[model samples]
Target: MSPRRSRKTSFEDKMARLEAIVEELEKGGLELEKAISLFKEGTKLVEELSEMLRDAEIEIENLYSEDDLNGD
Candidate 1:
């Protein structure tokens, strides 16, 4: 297992890590325990990424509404 991480990372960094995990999983040589662990981590990253995108969508909608109100 990898050492625990203490520092905060950006969304892009998380995405990159997720991508690496996916590539590793796709190669298909990991033991069951390791595969399960990677799968769990990847799932969590996906949830976080989804939430971030959802929040961004809401922000964009708000900006459009404000622009409409101001006749921009």
Candidate 2:
């Protein structure tokens, strides 16, 4: 996926695509080039998804820390 398209795509959509790629790879019989292409895309999606999760975790932590500071 292009960087622009990926930026617009939601995390759930990327995860679904990654799952589909894994299923296809697992099933076998893909041409070597196609399989490699799918593998690259899957890895890219994994990186993007991991970053998104990390960002969310940081945001949540910050929110809770702010609450603690406020004695809420």
Q: lDDT for each of the candidates?
A: 0.83, 0.88
Q: Give the alpha carbon lDDT tens digit for every residue of 7-72 in model 2.
A: 667777998999999999999999999999999999999998898777453333355676688896
Model 1 quality (TM-score): 0.64
Top candidate by lDDT: 2
lDDT of 2: 0.88
Task: State residue 10's C-alpha deviation in candidate 1, in Å.
Answer: 1.0
Q: Which stretches in model 2 have alpha-carbon errors above 4 Å?
A: 1-9, 55-72
| Alpha-carbon TM-score of each model against the true structure | 0.64, 0.64
For candidate 1, write residues 1-72 as lDDT tens digits.
Answer: 333332235577889999999999999989999999999999999999887667453333454676688896
> Model 2, residue 8: what's the lDDT?
64
Give the lowest summed-lDDT range of ten residues in model 2.
55-64
User: What does each candidate score in C-alpha RMSD?
Assistant: 9.1, 7.4
Worst ten-residue run, lDDT, model 1? 1-10
